[model samples]
Target: MSQAAGGVGKRIAKGSMWLSAARLVVNLSGMVSTVLLARLLVPADFGLVAIAATLMQIVTSITEMSLSQALIRLDDPTDQDFHSAWTLSMLRGVTIAVVLSASAPLVAHIYGDQRLVPIMIVLGCGAALSGLANPWLAVFQRKLVFWQEFVLSTASKMTNVIVAVAVAWYFQSYWAIVAGIVGMYAATVIASYCILPRLPRFSLASWRTLLSFSVWTSASQLVNALNWRADQLLVGKIATPTVLGYYNVGFNLANLATRETTLPLIQTLFPAFAAIKHDKPRLAAAYIRADRLLVALGVPVGVGFALVAQPMVPLFLNPKWLPAVPIIQAFAVIFGLQGIAGLVTPLGMAMGQVRLLFMRDLQVLCIRLPLMIAGAVIWGVPGLVAARVLTGLYQIAIAMLLAKRLAGVSLMRQLRTHLPTLISCCAMALAVWWVAGTGWRLFAGYDLAQDLVLRVMVGGIVYIGARVILWIVMGRPEGLEREAANMVGKLRRRPA
Candidate 1:
């Protein structure tokens, strides 16, 4: 590797670690908060809030300018660039707040729940506060300096957890979730300014420059949001609040395994890819390496979570949430497999292929919305879950094709890259299933918590063992195994 490539890799690695640590803290706290809220409130409470949240997301997505992304993409963004991004963000936020608040009554009527009116209005205010965050924060991302982001995310999420839990305990209402959402956004805006210490000026001097790049990005965001949330919206409309609540919580739990694992890498990849976009060879190599690592790390967690869902759901969430078990089990593996194409968006963005991304999202939405609607109408939640799995698989193929087109990495080669992780995960899953299925028969009197712990332990051991054996059998190729060894070496060599 060239000195520049090596330097970029180091920065990317460091930034990823920081962001990953932040995600770790955030996910841990989030899980705790979810557990507390689940115990304190009924599924109906979550269902009611999920309806309002989905509408809020749809509104925000439609108006997304992606100014922060544009600012990050710029080689040398000036103060005017930052100011313009901030101004556009503020404008977008205000627009979303107004639209959401205005549509509250209609949304309530559509969902047949008057409670949505207040929840939607409160969430709209949160959206506006989100726009007030410092645009200069993009500078840290541009430079791959993520410690400040770490601080900002951790503080905000911790605040959310504390406030949500307190409110849930005291009020025992769905409003607790709404309060947490608003509190997180408010905390983010406050923390952003404190970390960056920037007094953002309102300006339009560079609006054209920012928006020119962001228009396609905004379209992509809108489509992507719809692609993910359409099912939830349909469920909210067709199903009861209690059922929607079950689906929402289950989907989120499934997401935790995949999103928490791959998202940190995805968050860092855009700036990292952009930094080296001029070097095609290095970029291609980096893309493949990152893709492999994501799959290798994410797949086991996802599949393992699915493997243990039977026991895990009952243990952490209690029997009341057992209805969510199938949802978690089905989606966990699907989301994990999604890591195969997880980096596609960042790759496209870095290659200045936002138009292609928008097109891709549009294509998926066309396929997904119809399937989602049919599934929901025909089979209810189970049908919807099955439809999502099918669509998710289709998306993986689309992402692979896009990756091949942009990076010239063939589909076969990409599949090969994922082969080792796939094999190891399969091994891990089989071992865990055996323990849960057959071994549990051998070991009598095992409670839900014990079964969950045993399965997790067995799965982790099997995955690591299989991975190592595969690496050796494959001649210790340059991939995640090597990367892990190198990181370990560096850590060991450091002063105590």
Candidate 2:
């Protein structure tokens, strides 16, 4: 790499740090607020609000296709680019907001719930303002100024929690929940306005150029919206609205860890990767490096949560939501593989293979929707979750191919990087199951607490010991050879 390119790499690395930390802070806050909100509101309230949000989501997904990734791929966008993009966003904002606000009564009429009209209107306002945000946020990302975007995103999300939770505490109604929604978009607009760069005048050339992608991207958004929210609609239309609430809450909660961790990686690294598409070797290295890092992070977190879902769920949500427990666990396990998909999606677009990526998602949605509907009819919420989990396995194979073909990183190389991670997940699952089977009861007398502590201690020792041994045996822990050798010496000194 040249000195200039090396500087970009270093800066990308630094920016990745800021972006990752911002995601961590924001997601953690959002998770806490979810727990609190679940406690404060009734299932009906959550259900009602969820329906409105899902309806808005179906719409929001349709409209959001134009901005981020398209801008990322453009090499050297001009002021005309900015002017046209900003105009596109503003126009979408007004159109979507009005459509949502107006459709409220119709939605209420369909769902037979008169209360949803105002809620949908509020959500529509949020949708409207969301379209008004930093077209330059994309520019910030394009320039590898991911940290600036990170700061704006994090601060905006925190505002959502503060406004939503405070209002919920006093009002204890769905409107307070709506306030949280309002606060989030309000924060987005305010932060983007303050931090993103000033725009140039609206230019006809730029308008025409961006319009090409804007239209297709919007179409992409619609397809994605339907495919993404298919489960919510199926569950709501077929199952009880309350069941849909439980289903969405559980699904979103389960996905939080993967979504939070991997999203920033995509946002930061896709632009970074796009900038280096001409350099195959550099692109390959970056892809492998990112794949390894993501697998290491995502797999363990997902599996560990899956294993420990019992205590984790009730600890966060009320027991009334116990039904969501198994569903959440299934999702966490499936989503853990999402890190692999994360590497694929951006690598695809970076290499101009996004059409393939879209086609793959299109396929998944086609299979997944019918199965999800069948599952909702038969298995109810868990069936919907099972369909989602099933999608992951098929997608992983496609992700592997994309990794190899697009980035020149072989599928074997990618799997080799994650072999230990796979082992670690299995270890966590086995340890949790063994400990759980031993009936380490903890809700009883003092004995229960003592038994619980013992279970955790033993489970940790066994799980970690197995992973360390496998890591050594597989020759994947060469980087930790010195530490392993020292541990061997210490073990030899013991009374055996």
Candidate 3:
């Protein structure tokens, strides 16, 4: 690698480390909050919040101008640019809040649950507050200096968990969840200024420059949000709060394992990709390396979590959440497969292909919305899950094709890059399944916890063993394995 490439790699590694540490803290606190809230409040509490949150997301997506992305893409943004981005962002937030607040009664009527009106109104306020966050935060990301991001995210999430759990324990009402949502955004806005200490003026002097790049991005965001959240919205209307709660909890838990694992890296990849976008070969190489590492790490966690969902749900969340086990299992596996093309979005954005991305999202939404509606109408939640799994696979194919077009990486090469991790994950899944099925007979006193532990251990062992053997057989290929070795060597050689 050239010195320039190596420098980019170092920046990515350091940035990823900081962001990963933040995610680790956030996810752990989030899990604790989830468990505590699940016990203190019923599924209906979760269901009510989920419905309101989903609606807020849809409305927000519609108005999202991708100001941060626009700012990041600029080679050198001026004070005017930051002020314009902030002005637009604040306006978008207010728009979302007004739309959501005005639609609250209608949403409540559609769901036949009057409780959602207040929830939606409150969440809309939170959305508006989020707009006040420092627009200059994007500069840290653009420069690949993520420590501030780490502090901002961790502080906000910690505040959310602390406030939510305390409220749940005391109030024993769904208001606890609402309070947490508002608190998180408030913390975010406050932390953003505290960290950067910037006084952004309200101006649109650079509106044309910002909006020019964000037009297609906004379209893509709207479509992508609808594609992802339509099912939940539909479910909230068609099913009872309790049912929606189960589905919501299951879906979140399933995504938690995979999303939290890859999100830090994905966040870093945007700026990293942008740094090398002018050099197609370097950009492509970066994408491939990032995607491979993501798959290798994400696939095992997703699949392994699916394998253990049956025991995990009961052990961690109690029997009331058992119905969520299958949902968790199904979505976990689907998310795992989707990670194969996880870096495609960053690649496209880095390459200035927002129009292509918008088209891709529009196509998926066209196909996904119909299938999801049909599935929800026919078979309820299970049918919806099945439809999502199908669409998720389709999305993966579309993403891979997009990667090829944008980066000039072939479809064949993309598949081959993921083959080793895919195979290792498959082997691990099979081993765990077998151990949980017939192999349990060997232990005289096998329990749910024991089975879960045994499966995890076996899966970890089989996956590492298989991955190592494959790496060796492939002549120590220059990929995640090599990266791991290099990282280890660096750590060992560091001065004490």
Candidate 4:
């Protein structure tokens, strides 16, 4: 490996470590908020909010221009670039807010839920606040200074949870959720400005440069969001708010597996990839290394979640949410497939191949959107999830093919590299399933929560032990063991 490649690898590893810590806190806090709101607010409340939230997502995506991404990709972005991006972002936010507010009644009518009107308005304002967030935050991302992002992001999530819990406890309505979102965005925007403390000029001087990059990036983002969220969008229209709420919970829970594991990796890689885009060898190496780590971590998390869902649902959630158990299990598998596929977009952007990313997303949308609609209409909730699982598999195939073409790494090599992790995860899944399935049979006296905790502990141990032993057996396949030893060596060499 070149010195540059080694440096980038270490930076990514260190950055991911920091980001993982931050996202762990963020996810935990989010879970707390989800649990509190689930218990306090009814499923219908979540459903109503889901309706408005979906509309807001659609609006946000439609107006999304990824100027932060552009800034990161540019080798030497000037102040004018930042000013231009910020100005465009502000306009996008205001435009989305106005459009959402004006369309609130129509959106409510479409969903046959008038409660969405006010929620849409509130969420719209929140979206606008998000737009005004200082673009200088990308400066840290561009340089792989992720710890600051960790601080800012975690603070934002903590603020969201505190305000959300208090409002949900007091008001006991969907407004609590809406208000919490507003607070979270407000906090994030404030933190961004504090980080840089630079006022952006309201100018269009750099519009051409910014738009040249962002046009395709924004299109891909819009299509990608639509592709993934089409089920929720369609389900909200056909199903009751309560049903949509259940689906939302299930979907989010499933996402916990993939998103929590891969999110930091993805965020860390975009800038890293862009830095070495001209160096094909280094870029490909970084891409493969990242892929291996994601599969190693993500597959087990998704499988474990599926294995424990039966016990987890009853223990952590109220009985009213029982319907989401199967949905969560199915989506878990889907997200596992997506854990690797999610790399396609960022990789393309980093390679200055945004048009290819758009084409890939457009391909998925052409197939997946129709399937989602059919599934929602024909089989209802289960069908919706099943359709997504199918799409997930499709995305995997498409994304890997694209990876081979863009990165010059064959699909067979990619699959072979992940094979050990796949085998280990499968073994771990079986072990977890057996434990969760028959734990009560073997140890008949524990309460549901105790049983769940025991199963999780056993599952985690089995998974880790199996992964380590299998890797050693495979001759330390993927170099994970080597990486661990290297980390230990570095730590020991440091002053105690």
Candidate 5:
């Protein structure tokens, strides 16, 4: 391997650790928040907050500087690059906050929920803070400072929980929970500046250097952000806030599996994909490997969740959230399929296949938007859940085609690579399902039949051991052992 190649492997190692650590931190934080808010507040409270946050999300996303992306993607970004990015960020942040604050009441009126205005304005502060964050945090990620990212992610979220819970308990209103989001993000912005080795300052000259780099990424990210949140939009319009709240909870849990699994793939595989950007052969191999890993990681995890969806939801989010169980299972399966097509999006993005990436999303939108609308109209909550799963399969089909066309990741390559993981996951799911006697027997308010704990434990351990045996026996996954060893080195480097 060349120095850059070695760097790519090391970076992947670091990204994996950082993302995994971040996932754990975020999940724990998310779990805590979900429990507290669910116990203290009702779906209606979550519903009120969701509408404001969703609109604010649109603002934050559209106004994004993509400074981090600009810095990381540029072949030779400079200090000036960092400075310009930060300047652009701060201006945008301030602008969004002011606009949002002014428009919050109007937004709430349009949504037919006047109470949402204050929450919208409250969350708007985060828009400004995010925009003002030191753009050099990208460099931390670029430099693979995984541990710092890990600590900061955990700490910031823990802060959010502490504040949110304290205020919610004292006031017994949803405002405290809403404000917690804004406060935590502000905290994160400050923490990022402190932790980053070289913080970027405001500079016009630096701004000029980064514009071209920032524009495309910013557009892509903006569109992507909108795309991700569209389901919420559909639900909010067609269903009641209480109904949308269930949808959000369902979506959240689904993401916990897919997002947790592929989160590292995006960061780690990007550098690797960037390296082999010019080589079709290497790119093809890389995509297949990534696809296989995604399947291996996602399939079992998703399947496990689907198996235990009923039990897990009640235990995690309270009985009031039972409506979310079906939706969560639906999305879990969707994400599982998408997981198998993971490389298509990143590989497409990295290889200047922006048009392909956009088109694929467009195709997904084409399939999803209409279906989502129709489903929301017809089935209401259940329709929402089915629409998500159906649309996901539609997108996955398109994703596979794009991977085939762009990266030459063939049908056989995908099948051959995924067969073992798929089989193992299926076998385990069946075992769990069988043991649960089809998840049918109810004990008290919950089903006691699904032995989620035992099923997941035995299945996961067996599947993982099988994968390890295969990886070693076949001498496959070109960099498998090296990556494992690299992970060990990273763990050793962590502070006591």
Candidate 6:
């Protein structure tokens, strides 16, 4: 490898480390807050918020320009680019605020719930605040040095959790959920300017340049959001608010693992890929490695969570949330598959193939919207979630084609990378099942809490044991042995 390639590799490694640390901090706080809120509040509270949140997401996504990505893709960005992007953002924010404010009452009336009116309006303001955040943050991603991004993202998450918990304790209503949502964006906008120390000017000198790049991305974002939020939309529309809340709980819990683990790595890849987009060999290599890495991490967590859902649910959540247990199990596998498939979007974008990305999402949206709605109408929340698994398969197939066309990464190569990880995870699941069944038979008197803790411990040990054996059998592919050996060498050389 050239010195340049080595340097990029080092930067990617460092950036990933920082992002992982940031996700750890954020997810810990989020989990604690979720536990407290779930105990103190009820499903209806969450459902009420989801009603307004769904609308706000649609509006924001429909209008999003993805200016940050455009900026990041540029090899050399200028001050005018920043100013123009900020200008576009300001206009977009105002538009979202106005549109959301206007549509709030209609949405509330449609749902026959007047409470959503104020919540929708408030969420609009939050979206606007998000629009005002510093564009300089993109520079961090562009350079693959995300220390400031870490600080900004972590501070916002911490602030969000703290405020939400305090509010929920006081109000015991959906207002706590609102507070968290708004607080996170406000915190991000404040920290963005402070950390980057940039005063964005209102200008449109680079408008044409940015729009040319972001137009397709904007379409993709809109369709992507529709597909992403289709289930929530369907649930919120057909089911009772309380039912929607239960579904939301399951969805959120399942998604939390993906967001914290697979998402951080995927987010880092866009710029990393862009840096080497012109080099097909290097880009393909990185893509394969990343695919293997995400599968190795995601499969175990998904399968483990699915295995222990029954015990874990009653222990961590209130009994009222027991309805979400099955939903959680279904989505655990879905999210695991999604983590592997979701890589195609950023990779496509980095290769300047946003049009392909947009088309893929559009195809899914056409099929997914009707499918989710029918499922919800026919079988309720569980059906809606099951519908998603089918859609996920469709997406994975499309992603495989995109990988082949854009990166020359064949499906066989992809399967080769994922095969060992998949096999090891299956072994781990079997081990966990055996352990849990044996423990249940022996300790008939154990409560859910004790059972959950024991099962989790046993699952972790089994999974690690299976992974180690597989690693040796697969010749320690994807650099696991090398990374471990390097760490050991560093430990030996340390002064301590």
Deviation from truth (RMSD, Å), model 2: 4.5
Give the per-residue lDDT digits (tens) of candidate 4, residues 1-496: 5786678778877898899998899888888888888899988888777777777887788877889898888879998899899999999999989999999999878777788888888898999888888887888888788887787788799999999889999989889889888999999988887777887779888889989998888888789778867688787788888888899888888887666777888888888878877888867887887788787777878877887787777677788898988988898877876777767777888889999888988998998888888888899877878788898899899989998988887888888877776777777777767766665544556467766776678778887787678777767654676789789999999997
Ranking by TM-score: 1, 3, 6, 4, 2, 5
Who wins the lDDT comparison?
1
- Residue 36 lDDT in model 2? 86
Write down the TM-score of every candidate. 0.96, 0.89, 0.96, 0.95, 0.87, 0.95
RMSD values for the candidates in order, in angstroms, are 1.9, 4.5, 2.0, 2.1, 4.5, 2.1
**How far does residue 214 in candidate 6 sit from its true spot (Å)?**
0.8
Off by over 4 Å in 6: 441-446, 474-496
Q: If both were scored by lDDT, which would come out higher, candidate 3 or candidate 5?
A: 3
What value of lDDT does candidate 4 attain over all alpha carbons? 0.82
Off by over 4 Å in 3: 439-446, 485-496
RMSD versus native structure for model 1: 1.9
**Candidate 4 Cα deviation (angstroms), residue 400:** 0.7
Mind sharing the TM-score for model 6? 0.95
Clashes of each: 0, 0, 0, 0, 2, 0
Error of 3 at 270 (Å): 1.5
**Between which residue pairs do clashes occur in model 6?**
none
lDDT of 3 by residue, 1-496 (tens): 5887788788889999999999899878888888888889988888889999988888888998999999999888999999999999999889989999999999888888889898999999999999999999998888888999889889899999989999999999999999998999999999999999989999999999999999999989999889878888988878988888899988888788887788899999988887778888877777787888898878888999999998888887888989888989999988878888688888889878899989999999899889988998999888889999999999999999888888878998888899899999999989998888875643677477787888889999999999989999999989878888899999999999
- Model 4, residue 193: distance off in Å is 1.4
Error of 5 at 39 (Å): 1.4
How well does candidate 4 match the true structure in TM-score terms? 0.95
lDDT, candidate 5, 1-496, per-residue tens:
4687677767777778787878777887777887787787777777777777777777777776556666777887777777787788889888878888899888777778888777767677777776766666776666655666676777678878888888888887878778788778877887777786566676878665566655555566566666677778777777788888887877877887666766766666765676688989877876776776677677777877777787677776688899988878888877876787677766866676665576566566667777877887887767766777777777677777788888887777667777777666767767666766654432554343345565666667766666677677766555444478679999999999
Model 2 / residue 438 / CA error / Å: 2.9
lDDT of 1 by residue, 62-169 (tens): 998888889988878999999888889999899989999899999888778788888888899899989999998888888888999899989999999998999999
Question: Which segments of candidate 4 are over 4 A away from where they belong?
Answer: 1-4, 441-446, 485-496
Supply the TM-score for candidate 2.
0.89
Quote the positional error of residue 217 for candidate 1 in Å.
Answer: 0.5
